[model samples]
Target: MATSRTGLDEEFIGRLETSLDIYGIRQDPSLPPLQQTYMTVRAGQDGSAGSARLALPAFKGDKGDPGDGFLWQGDRTSAELAALREALGTDQRNWAYRNSDNNDLWVWIGSRFVISPDAFGAEGPEGPAPILVGGTVTVNGEALDQPLGTRVVGSDGVYSLGVDLPELPKGEPGDQGEPGSIFSSPDITGGPTDGQILVFDNESGKMVWRDGYLGPKVYNVPASAFGDWSSGLTGTRHIITAITIPAQPYRYRLDFDGSVEVSSILGQTVDVQVRADDPDTGAMVGVAYGNMEATGWVNQRFHAYSPDPFTPDTTGIRVGVVEPGVEQTLHVVAVKSAGLAAAWRVAGNGRSSLRVKLERMP
Candidate 1:
């Protein structure tokens, strides 16, 4: 073992360590520190290259290939509102996309790149993900108008979603229809002293009656469209009377309480009506037949005529007059059907009085 004194020359040692296949490479010690590759020294006289050098290049790997260009991930990382912008070459304009879940950006990969979700998004280490811009989420093409978290439980045709969401509200039915009308007769001091003149509404506005006392009706009646007054139609001795409107006006259908109807006053049959006022001139219009009648009075009976086809036409009411000696007997009176058109009263452009009788039967 002859040892020559080569005073630990730093330069000479550097070249030796840089050469491939050296014992000092793998162990990584300072024999001649000039590290660029990981090396291994082969020691065997029988081998082809007696002292083989295994050169393994070593350099810090880049912060990962900016990603395989295209990235796929699960839920987005951060909030969508705070997503970073990606500079994807010249096509930067198309890079316009609001953060879906959260982390959404363009990663740099080799010579080319792909649009992918942000690293922080889902599985940040895995790479990019699909950016869900906007999608169609509907049930059988029906739009989702309900608020989020609606308790929707329906399988095919069987629905069973009991609402449980905090925001979703319970469904409610529509408001009840205007109350069915309840009317009475009016007290007049004129006309046939024995005839009964009744008025009321049958849910809708159709007033009618007969000449004799009647009872409750169950079935609707069938009548003609003839608009002829029952001229001389006696009622306990009331007849021969005329009906006319104080003026002509384009009055509309009747309105009760707070409800309004669109059905025209003219029906398929006779459009019987009363005097309607003329809005422009306060004049009288053509005669429209009255729709109701009252007939029947053994006593001062109180009946409720729910505007029926015929019988029991009056409600808690009756048509009778007081005869001094005839046990205060009575006769039909002369009163026409009063409509809520433009003329229930002479008072213009204001609420007027309608004829609703509230009699005290004896």
Candidate 2:
């Protein structure tokens, strides 16, 4: 390289450093200082050749013919005015509906505003909501009976004009029915006696009176005869006593005592039986048997009865015994009859006898 003594090269390098610093070039290490161009012009002229300057031209000319207008905008014609009038009429008649006399106003939404009934002379394009004032109002031709600020209720089914309605009056009661039938009392032919009471007899369909006994009557008969004997009677029923009853519907029972004496050496058999007969015919009605076996005096009791509801041939009982060769006598000691409503002695000695009783068993 050749050296210069004039300093022009130094000056040129200084100017380049200054330009890089102004452009923030070194911090952007990947690029060199940017390239640029310059123009030469005289101050106060806009590069135009004429008298005009660079200042924005005074907003000239009346906004250069203000441009087009909206959808329904144009010069009005008779047909357009007629259509508008028809629209206003339809809105008044349908949307903002009112009766023919225009006494009331309604807002059907989609209609122009109207003055409220209570505003200043009630005049402005009144808005959608209506304010009520003192007025006559009718719904479905039935006039309301209420005043302003009072809630109006519609007719429930009955129709009425504006007059207040009153409640209806009540009705009177009806008359009574006639008396039922009654029969005459019959004559007292064989009237009720002293202790009798009146009763209705359904079988005869009549009222009558009678004395009544309600249930079967019972009878108790105790022993009225008793005796003891020691005679040796064998192999036969010796008659010791008897009791008699009348022929009728009766239940007969006999209770008695009998025994046999026996030797200590031999086994002996003694038998006792009851004999029932018809006293008038001497024919037997029934019989019951019993026995005893022992070495000494073996004593026993015997109770007997005829079949239930028995009408034993004029009924009578005979107590007898058999001594089977043991040198002993069978004794009939006590006897009694329990039956239908009667008691008496029938037959036997002072040593052996019977008592009778009669019960109303039926």
Q: Which window of 10 residues has the lowest lDDT sum in candidate 1? A: 255-264
Local distance difference test, per candidate? 0.28, 0.34
After superposition, candidate 2 runs with Cα above 4 Å error? 1-226, 231-235, 246-267, 278-291, 306-359
Write candidate 1's Cα lDDT for 1-362 as tens digits.
33444775334221122235333233343333333333444334444232343444445443545422333333333333234323244443233342355545533342343344553435434434323232333555554554434344444345554433233334478888876533432332223223334444465454444233322212111122111132122211112112221221211111111100111122111121212232222212222222223221101111222232322233332332112222111111222233223111111122211221212222
Estimate the TM-score of every prediction. 0.16, 0.22
lDDT of prediction 2:
0.34
Error of 1 at 114 (Å): 4.6
Which model scores highest in lDDT?
Answer: 2
Q: Candidate 2, which ten residues in sequence have the lowest lDDT sum? A: 13-22
